[model samples]
Target: MKNELWQLSACELAEGIREKQFSAEEVIYSVISRIDEHNPRLNAIVADYREEALIAAREADRAISSGEKTGELHGVPVTIKTNVDVEGKPTPNGLPAFEDLIAPADAPVVRNLKKSGAIIIGRTNTPELSMRFTTDNPLHGRTENPWNEEASPGGSSGGASSAAAAGFGPIHHGNDIAGSLRCPSFCCGLATVKPTFGRVPAWLPSATAERGMLAQMISVQGAICREVRDVRLATRIMAHADPRDPFWMPVPFEGWPEMPEPVRIGVTTESYDHPIHPDIVESIERAADYLSDAGYAVERVATPSVNEAAESWLRYVGNEIKTYLMPVAMEHGSETIQQIFEWFFQIGGVSDAEDYREGIKERTSMTREWNLFLEKYPLILSPYLMQPVGAWDSDTKNIEELRKFLNSGIYSLCVS
Candidate 1:
């Protein structure tokens, strides 16, 4: 029964708890045990309150026994990235300087997760500021991949991905700017989607959102999971209209596609000139081939680049992010963002009228380019990374490369 419990989906686990097939305590303990066995090796969890988790599990059980409608995640253990706020937990966002900075309140995403009946089991590690794709922070050290501890688990979301892949949780909340979520999912062999931008609200008290060229780009907060159904479930749980977020667009919660068991899929191991690992290319093709055999259109082709999406991400996020680095910069800290800031600082943090016009011109061209592509393919299959995961040490090896994005920070943490 214990082994069987490990195989259950998020929904299945909830049902078991609800039906008294097993108590919430049973479920939580099983998960906690898994975390104990695996997380130490993976080093994914930086801070944990297992005793608190058990108490929360009891409350969830009581709520169920009292006949109140239990939340979707009642008794389900979920790991929050250290970057996100969780009451007493300091949302360091991978920064050592802010390790003592506790959030007075839960971030909206956390509030929503709790409202939906999920248990906050632990906090995961992340690269400083979650700036890189590989997860390693000065405060919490690196999170190793489950498949190969020597390799990366991918950054920012790396700890989350590691936990999820190793069965730490059925679903994990994740954020993305430069592929923090998607890259790790690719490497870890899971499914994650970064919805059209602004779909997920972003509000961290200490953190600022990027501005300017990134205004139209999406900086969504969503979930990662082993099953597709869990993805949709967690998304619904978190996608409420937050008027506080100027960018939140209301998407239909009820009539999402209930397509056949197999949906039409467009698969590609290539996108632009960025080469993906041969094994990954083969894996994607094999998955596509299997899907094709399962009756889905598994065609290989070039995917549309969201024009200005990356640039827009930089700009919009930059607008807010530039400020995050300012205090640190003034103190001559953060060797990572310093060089990039150097270029911006030279311009005196002010774009000339001509520069503003040129930035706008580039955005228009990029948006136009993206729309042309998404128009054809509603769902795309593309490579998640260029190479296999390497030691977490690689990220800090050449601190200069962090600025260049040559070594994807926690964003590329994966099984490869």
Candidate 2:
């Protein structure tokens, strides 16, 4: 029973705890034991907080015993990605130079999770500056995929994905900028949702300055979990309003009036210049078939210009990186990461100052096009990455490989 406790979902554990079938301590112990046994090889968790988590669990159990009101995630163990602020912990984001940059307060998502009764078991790893498509850093080293060491677990949230897949906890807090949440989940066979921007509040209290305009628009906070229900639960909890984040919306998670009986779903398998894997095409088809059988009106049709949107993402974000992040990377980042950033500039087509300003305005028009398209279809079934998961070092091999990788994820980068 103790061993099997590690397999329970967040919902199951919470229900059991509330019903007095299991204590939060039992769940925490089980998860810590799992981490102790498996994390050495996986390197998913960068900072272990087993002692802190156990104490929190005890407090949570006492609260329930005293008949105090509890939040949705009462006594549940979760891991936070190292990139975000966790108050007093370092948000290194995989760079050794920033190891001592301790957070002054919890990020909005972390605060929301704690308010919901979630305990942080540990902080997970990420690539240097959380920029790459795979997780590896000079500070914490590489996070190995639980299934295969050679395959990437996915990044910038690869550590979160690895922990989720390896059963370290039911919920793993991860943020997405460019496929960080979705890519890792895809590689690790977990479920996740890259919540629409402003749906979840985000603010890194440790940061010395504000992020670039494009960064604020594209990046979003979310989670990865083993079960869809847990993803839904975690996302809702994380989406709770925090006064720190001005972008947060006071919208309900559910209760959107039901769409007509058969919901319209637009399905696209278009890969543009890149050759999409056959399995991906087949998987999309199978999903469409299943949706159709489930009474969704599935149609294989093109939507907005993904290529153009992707180009815009590259242009706008590339210029921002060049202006803002490049200096930091050059000074404190690894030689490999420095080279990777160069490749990014090459393929991203960094725009001039005038073009960058124009690109920012152009984003509104692009978003309008997508919003209009989404009105008719309501849902779009599209590939997150054109190909299956690649090797850990696939993107770092050469400029061409990195370019291909960026191209494959056009949908992910653009859609967000």
Worst 10 residues of 1 by lDDT: 407-416
TM-score of 2: 0.98
Candidate 2 deviant stretches above 4 angstroms: none
For residues 1-416, write the lDDT of model 1, one tens digit per residue: 86446557788888888887887787778888888888878987788878998999899889888998877778887778787778767877776678788887777778888887888888877776666667765577778888887777876699888888898878888887667778678657787877667666656654555433343354567787888888878787777666666777777777745555455566655433444457867877787777788777666665544322444334434444465555664463366545445543332244455655665676667667656664554456655555666666565555444433432222222111
lDDT of 2 by residue, 183-300 (tens): 9999999999999889999998988889998899889999999999999999999999999988888988888766786789999998887879999999999999999999899998
Highest-scoring model, TM-score: 2
TM-score of each: 0.83, 0.98
Scored against the true structure, residue 132 in model 1 reaches a CA lDDT of 66
Model 1 off-target regions past 4 Å?
3-7, 206-216, 256-275, 297-357, 399-416
Candidate models: Cα lDDT each: 0.68, 0.92
Model 2 clashing residue pairs (backbone): none
Backbone N/Cα/C clashes per model: 34, 0
lDDT of 2 at 202: 96
What lDDT is reached at residue 176 by model 1?
74
